[model samples]
Target: MSEQKKAEKIVGVKGMNDILPADAPLWELFENTVHSVLKSYGFQQIRTPIVEPTALFARGLGAVTDIVEKEMYSFTDSMNGDQLTLRPENTAGVVRAALEHNLTYDGPKRLWYVGPMFRHERPQRGRYRQFHQVGAEAVGFTGPDVDAELIMMCQRLWDDLGLSDIRLELNSIGNAEERNKHRVDLIAYFEQHKELLDTDAQRRLHANPLRILDTKNPTMQEMVNAAPKLLDYLGEESRAHFEGVQKILNHNNIPFTINPRLVRGMDYYNRTVFEWVTDQLGSQGTVCGGGRYDPLIEMFGGKPTPACGFAMGVERILELMKASGEQYAPNQCDVYVVHQGEAAQLQSFVLAERLRTAGLDVVLHCASANGGGSFKAQMKRADGSGAAFAVIIGEDEVTANTAVVKHLRAEEGAEQNQVSVEFDAVVDYVVDQIVGHGHDHDHDHDHVHYHP
Candidate 1:
């Protein structure tokens, strides 16, 4: 006997998720709502490559950042032996593209992007290795108004999504000069209390003293809280910028808390920084975070340009929506075509195309291997399709060049009726019955065109 073959079982990489068809409707709803909101704000969509030169992120995001030092997926290209890294975050690539193309040479531009981002980290309920982010960037904007506007845009999105648990946490890391002074004092403070510092804090004590403030270790909480606050060291210009942002937000009646410890993980951020966090997702609380990155464009070899933007985690936002019991049901089809026999199947295909051409969604059923199932089975499928009407084409109807249109979904006490329609008039009849509108049927009745 021949040796039996062993089947290899393969699965997707850990921390990467597959969005099945059952969950696609909610994702579509979120994307559509975001696109609509962005369009209303005059933000246009921009797409950048997923892989960029390793140097771009190291320089733009700072080599000391956890994203650069620990999480980036970097490798040397086999063909050219050049170093490349899958983008951990999109802001750096967007800035790189803007500078490369001189997008802001003439003037500033508002751009948005939506795609997956990679980061190697411990996966949890709203965190994954391969996650998606929807980011909006306003380039060449210099004032506090743009900062406030970005925050307001996020508020509008949360409102549009009917999400209420998320709240805004605002802060200012000040500019390089102010942060340097604060960093000096902060490191000194941590050094004075070195014995109390945790392993994570000790490692970041000098390399990234600011990040030590964001440690979540319960034992180090008091030490981190007592560490010098960046807000205390804000210079005149920096303080004015931050206050200006606050005034605008206050005027707009957007509630927020000024969090002195909200130092973001990215290095390019300075001045206005904010995060929309929620208690709904424990431990993974930040749903959206961004701030003003004024030096990013110049750092990328372009002329000095100021930009501000924000990105929200799609999976986390969807989780919040689900937890809040938000409903999103996909729109059902207008008609399902049930057919039998060779000629009837061919006619059904033609009729389904005709209905689609008239702007109706059609689902045409193909025959099974056993010469198609009984009519009852076909009807079961038609009902399962969530169609408002079922167009039945049988041998008798095929010979007469006609169809039976049965109303599958009807109001209570309303008659669930079926009517005979001429083959040429089927599209018009379905459209009028399903859409509750009449259309001018001006096409030649003799032509029976098949789309397939």
Candidate 2:
């Protein structure tokens, strides 16, 4: 008989990654920093589903936009024949939820969210098919102060994260009326330079003329630079709103540049738009970007509400952190309980729980089928666990109601010593030595630690 063929090994889907034990600490640190900063500004957390009606995004983001036209993971529901999409961006879903629940009917709300978003795009260094974002939204407020405050909040986050390279790029797209006038002029100019327009630019010319200004094509740079500026078409009210936002940022010492070509890709944005960009990440430089989208809530069938928000790519920010030499050390327990013999094993388990109850993290070594291994092997495992102290239990110690405590992590020039402690005194001894003595055995830090 012929030999049977082997099946192929399974792996994670492309561009979707798993956060392994080694890399989880950095993600936790980033999340903690974001939560603390958001809490400081009275922003509450809001969670929305990862899937929503396909029309939500098609309406929120323009149908011609890349996300809706190309990148979204959309499918037809088998049970009901409904069209559903894995959210490529979160702003639309958030607005849909707010409208569904009438969250802003009474007043304004400051909401934030952190979760994974899916987009079927070509994966690169910082961009992925499945990536995470930390977003903040201010709903039912129509003033420039909220816009400026959101920008300032982002600045505060960067400062807290020890990031110094990111800079702010600001712009104003005006309301629909002003944008219409500019759009007409912009389309006329693109028609004049039709020969120089690239395929992407030409395609976006009639659909989303404003996005043409953000083209990176070297050949079309000169033409795009000379296109009609949105800043010039701002009416009195729009200009004042733009100026109001700038004044607050200026007074707060937040330096920014007014970039006429910084129109964001979303169709919902209007009046004010800003991006926190950096030179570190190649090609994909905008780490965080958002702006005012006052018409979105009303468009979603809710009473007219003013809103603005922003979202930062978590993977990109974490990459920047790693590049800047930021370290997030893994959390380690304070004590590892090593045991031998049946009686000693039972006693080790009991004592480990006691130590844990006393606000200490303990790792109890379980007995193996191979005669529970040797004492040297168990001690090696204890040391490898990064514990500052190891509690040894044997038949003799179990009988005497005592444990042999060995100091595994010792300071420079300090002697590594072992001491005998009664079972009743073990918890206090471990706590005092680890916490009171400042041995730094506990991997406790002000920031969050990731658990796998």
Candidate 3:
């Protein structure tokens, strides 16, 4: 007989990360805060499929944009020969859904979404190939008030999250006509200093000249700085719209700076544009970015309707939260039920469910640690679970019809943290101490017996 070769072990895909148990608390807290804030503002939730037709991005985010050109995870469906792509950004998908469903046929809508967005870029801190975003869209809204409201909404969330270091940068890219005129002059001016442009800049020079203004290349800084400013070209209507947003933000006491070079990555945005940026994050990347895109509905083959929205990188915001010194105690559950022996195990299981029924999160210990049947080992696991209290049951207590509840996180030998209650009163006692329960319950059950 010949020995067989072992197969290699497979791991998760590169750049796509697993949110392990240790990191889930922070994510949950952030998500809850976002949901509450968005709901308070009357924004309903909207979910769209992760994959869409390849042409959606090509048309929505101009074909010449960097995302469409270099970063999208696109492929052809072999079975049906249909070109498909994992969405790089969600605004396009949202609009596609709105148009397809005629969701706005009656009136405008305020919507939000949170999900993973795929991109094929090289991953780094706070940026990933499979990243998550929380975004909002106000469709059929034509005024600058909605834009300012969206900005204020973000400010409120930051305040609630105890984040004070992030700052807002505001800008206006004007309408297509205004940008078109500026585009011609921009190309002419860049052409005059052709040698100073970087590879990315030169490639986008004619197709997406506005993006060239946002280049990070230090070599092209001087020329890009002096290039035609978009603000200078804003017409009367566009200038007023920009001023309207500023006026509202000023009234609301939300401070902001007008960064004339703040052109966002998307091609759909027009009129009002703003970004919440943080210097705390390395190199001052945008935490959230959005603007008014009044032409997107028409672009998606629907009636011309105005829309405004913003998307925030979840990984980046969570990084900022992690830096704020906010502590998340390792909380596995509210109650950990540890037991020994067959009789004690049966009692522990019943008590665990009763605690759960009383609205307490409970974890019943399994006899698998160390000796797989020792009280000391089970207690050790209970103490390490970060649970607030441990309910210990043993052969003696199973016979006595009582359980000893000990506080897991208390100082050693602190009698106040430890208490013993009748097995019937265990659930009520834990509920009252943990969350101040108001309901009353009675237990009238027989005990389990073991014979070997």
The stretch of ten residues in a row with the least summed lDDT in candidate 2 is 443-452
**Listing every candidate in turn, what is its Cα RMSD in Å to the true structure after a full C-alpha superposition?**
4.0, 3.4, 4.8
The order by descending lDDT is 2, 1, 3
Model 3 C-alpha lDDT per residue in residues 275-375, reported as the tens digit of each score: 89998888647899999999888988898999999999999999999999989655467788988788988888888877776656677887453564577
Q: Give candidate 3 misplaced runs (Cα > 4 Å).
A: 1-4, 369-372, 411-413, 435-452
TM-score of 2: 0.94
TM-score, every prediction:
0.94, 0.94, 0.93
- The predicted structure with the larger TM-score, 2 or 3, is 2
Clashing pairs in 1: none
Query: Best by lDDT, which number?
Result: 2
True-vs-predicted CA distance for residue 233, candidate 3, Å: 1.2
Total backbone collisions for each predicted model: 0, 0, 0
Model 3 residue 244 CA deviation (Å) reads 0.5
Candidate 2 structure quality by residue, lDDT tens digits, 195-298: 99889988998999888899888998887888889999999999999999999999999999999999977878899999999999999999999999999988
Model 1 stretches with alpha carbons more than 4 Å out: 1-6, 368-372, 411-413, 437-452
